[model samples]
Target chain A: MKLRSQTRVILPYLGILAVYALLMAVGVPWLVRRGQLAAAETGAGFNPTSLVIYVVVISVVGLFAGLYVNLRADARQRHALNQLTQATRDLGEGRFKELEIPEDVGPLPETQALKGALESTAREIQYRMEAILKEQSMLSAVLSQMTDGLLIADDNGRVLLLNKMAEKLFMISQEKALGRSVVEVMRHHALVELWEKFRGGESKSITLEMGVNRNFLQVVGIRLDDEIPGRSMLLFQDLTQTHRLEIVRRDFISNISHELRTPMASLKALSETLLDGALEDPPAARRFVVRMDTEVDNLSQLVNELLELSRIESGRTNFDFQRVFPCGLMAKACERMTLQAERMGLSVGQECPDNLPQIFADPARISQVFINLIHNAIKFTPAGGKIQLSAWQDGGFVVFRVADTGVGIAQKDVSRIFERFYKADRARAGGGTGLGLSICKHMVEAHGGKIWAESEEGNGANFFFTIPVAST
Target chain B: MARLTLDRELRLVQDEILILGSLVEQAILNAVDALRRRDIAAAMEVQHNDRRINNKRFAIENRILILLATQSPMAHDLRLLAGMLEVITELERIGDYAKGIAKVCVRLAEEDTLIPIREITTMADKAISMLHRALDAFIAEDEAAARQIPLEDDEVDELYNLVYHKLIQTMINDPQAIDHANQILWVIHNLERTADRVTNICERIVFIHTGELMEMDSEDDESEDEDENLDTA
Candidate 1:
């Protein structure tokens, strides 16, 4: 190819030189003859040696001119070829800069076309490279930002890629987890079993619950054959909160049924006794009526407590916010429970620094919380035991405590005491409605506060609640 | 080429060990949970799952034996397979303890006696936590963590003692409750033994790292002996 192109370039120069040579061959001798004729007419001699010298000098001059022009054209063509070679090298090495065709190359039309072709190829490659880079970054961004944990593993179960959420869910770092088997990384039998099943082609996708109780996760594994062959993708959705809510909901329904059924059974048995000739005995009938009245009263109390709890939980109960002094609130609660405490032979006391920060709370709801707590204390404590109410300031809130020298809650029941209808087995026997603490929890939280209890069985119990200090 | 096959086989064995470890862990957790909830059905399920744990252990043992016969791994790989053999045995024994607790749960369901379940649950928690960490140390080949984890066994022992005394007190207070109290005591005994087995697993971890077999509790025993000597003095 190179030889052929060089011949093409040289052929045009050769044609121009041949045409000039033919003109010289014909015209030079004729010019010499005319000189001879002119010399004879003027009675002078014409020399043949002079004619040969003249022909040789004119031919040498014409040949030199042709050689000079050909060399200059060849230099221009070589410069254009060098530029095209450099442009191709840069394109191969991924330097996508524009090809600079020199002005001297304007006469070489073939070289110009080659440079144009090189520039277009470089442009096409640059466009594709940019698009690929953009798509790669977009994929990584989406993977990192996803809420569900995403993991990609190869056919051999070695982890290939995992996003931030997946790393967090598995409590592993990407640097350490990559290229490790999924079974070794995850360490959950159920998950590994699912992976094995997916690998065996038993199922394309599988979902299973892994981890116990509070750390529950719903893991979904899918065979990923579209984007990358023989890889699996796992999506971990943490369901701990959902599981807890499900438990609470189930407990609520069961407890409500039990509470309703107990009183209804008693009412049914009492009416059945009345119908079986117990009404004919006047004094016995009066006793039965009083017992029926008490059962109905108990039922109504249960109903009212359930209604109140649901209302507060649903945020329908409007709290009338007030900046009440902490001591005043404690005193009012103690005063309300004083009569019952005295009847039970328990002494009620309130200890609060008068200078404590006032709390933002619904006065009535806050008082109800305090009264319910004290009532629980009076019920649980021995006849001579003391119930104390105290308050103090803790960062951004005023903390209130109701402590009692009573039979304390068991360790397991301490955390659950504030749950709706959750009664300690011991508390079940010595109970008002079990809704007191649950109501207290909701009311305190409605005031933008927190509530919790501390207890150990056979020792004493302390219930603490916090209300945000009224903004100055 | 043979070395590549050996490495792959070793990874497979490791995966099986982890699977077995998790099975034992879940069994322990479910058994104790069933006891606490008095769910006889869940207890029976845990009892049935013990066979699965046993099969897993045997399967791992068979794989280790095959690797030993075919690959004849040397030095560190040999120690790893040996340590894994010991670990799977210890894990299977722990699984049995879980089954024992499940049986106790079933027994308690038939009686009305109040068991001190809170202390028992705490003991199970401590033991299972120790076991979980020990397995992690084994997987990481961390000699430091393997050595440090056995110290927590003392906490489990202390809980065991607390429950033992509490059950004795229950028996002294009510003679008719002796059978139930003895059963509850057996549950704590199983838990204390589970923690001891976790210490054994930790020992194997250290062995895999340094090829030394020694009791992890020897230091605690020496400290106890000094305490006893001081008391006598």
Candidate 2:
């Protein structure tokens, strides 16, 4: 491509032609001036008039030979140029596999170096392109096959790229997702916050509670190589299980400590008192001993319940599941909780349609679930409040429900009523560890059933649990 | 030597893991005590005993890895090991944390009242206890308790945050107490990290086996301030 290098090759050929032309001009004249050199040779063969004519003829022949050599040099230059042009055209057409630059085109040293450099450049370019293709396919596969939701959005919150998982998670087709704002589709407040953080080119993760479900979105914002200033990607991962356990573990620790702390401290205090000779004072000793006994019983009960609840949750407990009449379980549950209901001056009543199909369940666990529900109703309901227990056959399942007329659960507390240690009134003391509803939930679930509650602050509350009917 | 397979020995493995988990938890408490008492000897004890913690971790880690390789374990086993990894990480962190506290102790060198370690000690104690209960739930496979651990961490956070502001106040009140106060703050920082770690352990437990997640950020939230704000508003 360089002009100077091209001139070096062309100049030599031009010089050779010039030298031939000079020989034809000056050398022929000298021979003619001599009037004898080639004339003598011609005269030897013929007369003086004939000799002059022969001399002229010899000079003409020499001139033709020089012209022929110059023509030959010009033809070779043309051939090289044509070859170069064809090779360049082929290279342009992307025939990368066979770019053969003719070695003879480099008549000069510099031109030879240029030819080698061009060949090496083409080879390197081919190698790099092949590598890029490989990388592109790998990236495409990864983007398509990944299970976790991936979203790459621009600085203005426009969704630029989304994977299959992302599409499924947002419930949108790819065409609908791209170029749309995240908020328009997801409408999740936490997601919006996450996007803003990402748009700022900051790496962060957010845990969001969507409706009743929990999820984790780990957004990794990297300033992309594009026009968008705050463009980044957000990866959505499902950490709901992990998140729930974390809450549970924390509550368990606090409850256990708070649970154990009271009794442990009491035990410690009682022992110290005994050590300080409180045992000598019979009345004080009696009270202290009685107190110690109560703490011991409470601790034992706590441990035992912890064990039982865990077994029920893990499906490790041997549940002799069977087809049981829902009315029977409800009756027994009320009978068990009757004394407590009476103490609270609340009536426990059941409603059931006769000839109800038998529901498959663990009888004891079902009874336990009902007892827990009624017990809670009795505890929270005011004296002289009414509690109704009912069952109905619906769609191959039996629905058991407890409805209470009392200080109803607040709208906020209603959602978390089933959570472990989720006491509506933490201030109200001397109740269980608040694991009752949680245990009831797990027990029901272990039987392949489900439970839920409905409540309003002023109006009374209703708790519903369902067990599927066993095939006859 | 008897060949111990994971599936056949799951219950036993779980019990052992819980025990080791509790010991590391107790170590976290001990480290907090080291700083609170300003006892170099106790700090040295925590630093020295950290090897024991690591040894326990390696044992658990080896078991988990072997189980994964040999047992062809399906869901629950997978979750248990995965949970164990998190628990081990928390334990390792607590051990490193103990060493960090020891380093602080050696630096402080018998200074009395140069720091405010009381609130931090309270927070760490709470965190340590939380770890124990989380482990207990794991052993019992008590989903309810497991789900509640994160809820408790929020309370720990509140306490640590309280200590955080108090330390800043102390430093402002007396510039001379700044160095000692910072050390106290560091311990509190470690305690808070420990609490967060315990929450991770809790999540692992539930994921191993349990119910669906119903809420987010149940990390020991007192809602004390929120309730007051609502009342005022």
Candidate 3:
């Protein structure tokens, strides 16, 4: 190819030189003889020296012109080749800008055609490269933003891809986990078994619950036999919150059933006893009837308390918030419980400062909270023990306390006392429906306050609650 | 070519060890959970699953023996295979401990005494977590991590002590509860032993890295106390 191009450049110059040689060999000699003949005819001396010199000078000028033209043609070709080399270098370096081919390649058509082809090839590659990059970035963005964890592994169980959620779920870094075995990363036996099942064609997809205690994960594995042979994907969905809610719901159902059964059993036994023959004796019949009446009243109270608890829990119970003196609410609650406290040999006392800040709360609900606490205090306290009601302003709320000398709550059951139907060990024997503290919790929370208990078993119990101070 | 085959076979053995580790971990968790819920059926299931864990351990052991015979691994590889053998044994024993807890759960179901389930579950959590990290250190050949993991065993021991005293107090207060208290004590003893086994696994990890067989947590007196308690129970 190099020889052909070089020969093309020199061919025209060679043809010009050949024509000159032919003229010098044949035409020039003939012309010289004619000149000599003319000179002989004219009887003058025939001197051919000046004619030869003239022919040599013209041939030298023509040769210099051909050399100059060939040199200029070579320079243009070199310039075109340099441009093509630079474009190829830029393409290799990923700079896919337009190729700047000169308008002319010094009359070499093949060079011009090569330059055109290079330009079009760069454009095609640039277009395809941009499309691929766009798809890649989109895929990465989707993978990173996914809520569920995603992990893709090869047939050999080596991790090929993992998303941000997958990294978080396994507590592993992507760079470290990739190319590592899935079993090593997950560290769970069930997942390894799931992978084996997928490998053996036992199943296409499987879901299982993994993790211990409060943090539960539902893992879904799928074998990708068709899309990419011998690859698999895992999706991890965290089920901890759902599992906790299910537990709470189950506990509530069991507790509610246990609470209802005791009174129902008594009611059934009393009616059966009366039907068996207590009616023949009027006094005994009357006694059994009174017992049944008390049992019915207990059932009614339990039903009513359950309804009130549900209403408060669901935010269906409205609070008529009023600015009332804290002292007045304490006094009212003490007054309501004083008779019962005295009957049980416990003294009910109120210690609220008259100048304390008024609280924003439903007056009746706040009184009910106080009455419930005082009633609980009276029920648990021995004779001659004291039940004290105190209120003070703290921060933006009024803190109320009902302290009693009684068998206090156990350490473990302290946190759970506010759960409906949860009773302290002592409270179980000293009978009242176990919904009192749970109702108190909801009531105080509805007033935008907090409630808690501080106690030591066999010493005393102090129940505290807060209500927001009415803004002036 | 022989070197490549040995590397591949070693990886296969390591994978089997991990599978065995997970099975034992699951068993421990299920046993403690069954005790908490007083679910006799679940406890029986955990008991039944012990055979599977035993089979897995034997399978891994056979593979390691074959590797030792055929590959004749020297230096670090030999140490690794040997450490793996010890780890699987520890894992199998832990599985038996889980089965022991499950048996206690079954026995406790027949009695009316309330077991201190919260403390036992916490003990199980600590021990299983220690085992998990120990296995991770083994896989990564991390000597430093293996050294650090045994320190968590102290926490399990503390919980075990707390549960033991509480059960003793219960027995002293109510003589009728002595039988149930003994059963509960056995469960915690199993958990304490499981934690001890986790330390053993950690020791194996250190052995794999440094090629030295050394005890990590040498609380010989405490382990003796545990053994005495187990025998009395």
CA lDDT of each prediction against the hidden true structure? 0.84, 0.72, 0.85
TM-score of chain B of each: 0.92, 0.82, 0.95
Q: Is the docking of candidate 3 incorrect, acceptable, medium or high quality?
A: medium
Please give the DockQ score of every candidate, comma-separated: 0.47, 0.01, 0.62
Collision pairs in model 1: none
Give lDDT for model 3: 0.85
The alpha-carbon lDDT assigned to residue A432 of candidate 3 equals 83
What are the per-model numbers of colliding residue pairs? 0, 29, 0
Output the better candidate (1/2) by TM-score: 1
TM-score of chain A of each: 0.74, 0.58, 0.82
**What is the C-alpha lDDT profile of model 1 across A1-472, one tens digit per residue?**
5567667667766876787688677867787888789888987877567667766876787677778878888787787788778777877877665645344453555776777777688778889989998999999999999888888899989999999988887778999899989987888888888888877765544444443333667777788787778998888887778887987788778878988888899899999999999999999999999999999999898889889998998999988897889898889878988999999999888889978987888889999999889988887888899998999998999999999999999777898899777778643444467898999999988888999999988887999999999999
lDDT for each residue of candidate 3 in B75-109, tens digit (9 for 90 to 100) = 99999999999999999988888888999888777
Cα deviation at A352, candidate 3, in Å, is 1.2
Q: Flag regions of model 1 displaced more than 4 Å.
A: A1-118, A202-207, A212-214, A226-228, A322-336, A349-361, A389-401, A427-430, A449-459, A464-472, B109-184, B220-233
Looking at model 3 chain B, report the run of 10 residues with the lowest lDDT sum: B224-233
